[model samples]
Target: MIDLRSDTVTRPSAEMRRVMFEAPVGDDVWGDDPSVTHLEHYLAERTGKAAALFLPSGTQSNLVALLSHCQRGDEYLVDQQAHTYRLEGGGAAVLGGIQPQPLDGLNTGELPLAKLKAAIKPVDPHFARTRLLTLENTFHGQVLDADHVAQTTALAREQGLATHLDGARIGNAAAASGSSLEALCAPFDTVSICCSKGLGAPMGSVLVGPEAFIATATRWRKVVGGGLRQVGSMAAACEYALDHHLPQLIQDHEKAERLAAGLAAIDGITVTAQATNMVFVAFEDSAFAPEPLHAWLAEQGILVGALYAPRFVTHRDVSMADIDQVVAAFRDYFQRLTR
Candidate 1:
């Protein structure tokens, strides 16, 4: 199937798979895996952070950051639609005892400085101590720029709050925004970047931050049962992806834009402005259910997502040929709906 569900669906490329198969393995939990250690150090250098910890998933990385940064009954502010707030199953609250204070949507991809300042507790005994401000770049591929990141982080700093970034698709955002990884990551105290999505690594993510912060996060990672043994294979795949796949992310973003434009041209369909590799297409007519359209596309060997709003994502696996097929499928579906 031509999967457009999410970049997380991508399989590792041939080169990545070869590296994984031939990787030198050792115990990572014991800090004896040379390749894993190398991957962590590589990510730290790339992000301009003092240290980094390789984690099983972005969720674990974010959760570990939250646990390390906040004590029980502490709160962190996040955008309402952020992945950590909406998608991470409330692990911050349930496991870390950290409460999430979601800010209302800010269209410009930044929280208003005044609103953020007001969200911070004013040394009150009755309130949950707000200790962290979590920011998400590309809230599902929207690509918030460095200026927005700088302004939001500046506000958080003024309120004495440390910042964490859920940078799952950070490479895509960096490619789209023309921002250096270091410059984009420098504002936040900690940032979790995924290797599996878009980058085509089979599995793994890295949490980067100051050496002191990462030391604490490592403790929390073990406490949360995230320690891995013989994970150098996965780390090797990430290294391969970084070297070979990261440079091609812009092509995926371009394909997403092309898909968005094609879908927008179809009657009764609305496509959001394309930024990275994700595109959200909505059927304007309430009666025009997405199920049949989705079914039709699947029958034509296109594996689209089943989201409530019907989201589509272009990934490393999808190509210009796949984009043409998707556009053709949309044309046929729209014509059928009209008839």
Candidate 2:
């Protein structure tokens, strides 16, 4: 089946598998895994950070970053819709005792500066001290403006708060916006880069920050049961993705644009948003049932997101030919409605 559910669904390519098989292995929990160390160093240099730590998932990476930046009872400012605050299972609050001060964000995924300034609690015993300000790039596939990111993060510094970026899809943001990874990351003190997403690695995320902060995160990672043994193969796969698949992100974004344009031309479908490698579409009429379309598309050897909101993600495994087929399938589904 042609899966458009998410980029995370991508399996390792034959080349990546070969690298994983040949990778030199050692116990990562002991900091002796050469492959894991290589991956960490590569990402650290690319993002211009002093050091990096490899974690099992983006969730853990973000959680560790939060734990390193904030102490118990301290809070962080984040957008209400940010993946770190809303989607990461609240690990910061549950595990680190860190509170989240969620503010509504603009369409570009930027926190309104006025509201952000007003939200920072003054020095008092009554409020949770704001310790960090977190931001996300490529929020719902829309790239956050670089200028806005600089401004918000600068404001964060002015208020004496540290900054972290849930850059799970930072590569996509860089590819789409024509910005360098280091340039995009310069505003924040720490960043979590997920290789499992558009990079097409089977699994792995690297958290990059200062050496001292990474040392702190390493301890939290161990405390949270993230200290894996012999993960060299996974690290090798992520390295392979960084070397081979990063350029393909631009092609994925192009395919998403193509798919969005095709669906928009259909009579009953509305293209609600398109950015990077993700496109969201919806039926023009709320009364329309999507169950039939889901079943029909499945019968045609196609798969999409199971959620009520229709989101299609283009990835390395999805080709231009496959994108055309998906567009035809959607068009055919709607054409049958009029008949």
Best-fitting candidate, measured by TM-score? 2
**lDDT per model, in order?**
0.88, 0.92
**Residue pairs whose backbone atoms clash in candidate 2:** none
Q: Please give the range of 10 consecutive residues that has the lowest summed lDDT in model 1.
A: 104-113
**Clash number for each model:** 1, 0
Q: Which digits, one per residue and each the tens of the lDDT, describe model 1 over residues 1-339? A: 899988999997777778898999999999999899999999899999999999999999999999999999999998887889889999999998899999986754578778888788877889999999998877778887677778888888877899999989888888888888898899999999999999999889999999999999999999999999999999999988887888899999999989998989988889855668988877788777677777898899999778467788899999899999989988997897669
Distance (Å) between predicted and true CA of 309, model 1? 0.6
Q: Model 2, 324: alpha-carbon shift in Å?
A: 0.9
List the candidate 2 regions with Cα displacement exceeding 4 Å. Answer: none
CA lDDT for candidate 2: 0.92
| Candidate 2 weakest ten by summed lDDT | 303-312
Identify the leading candidate in terms of lDDT.
Answer: 2
Writing each residue's lDDT as its tens digit, candidate 2 over 200-237 gives: 88899999999999999999999999999999999999
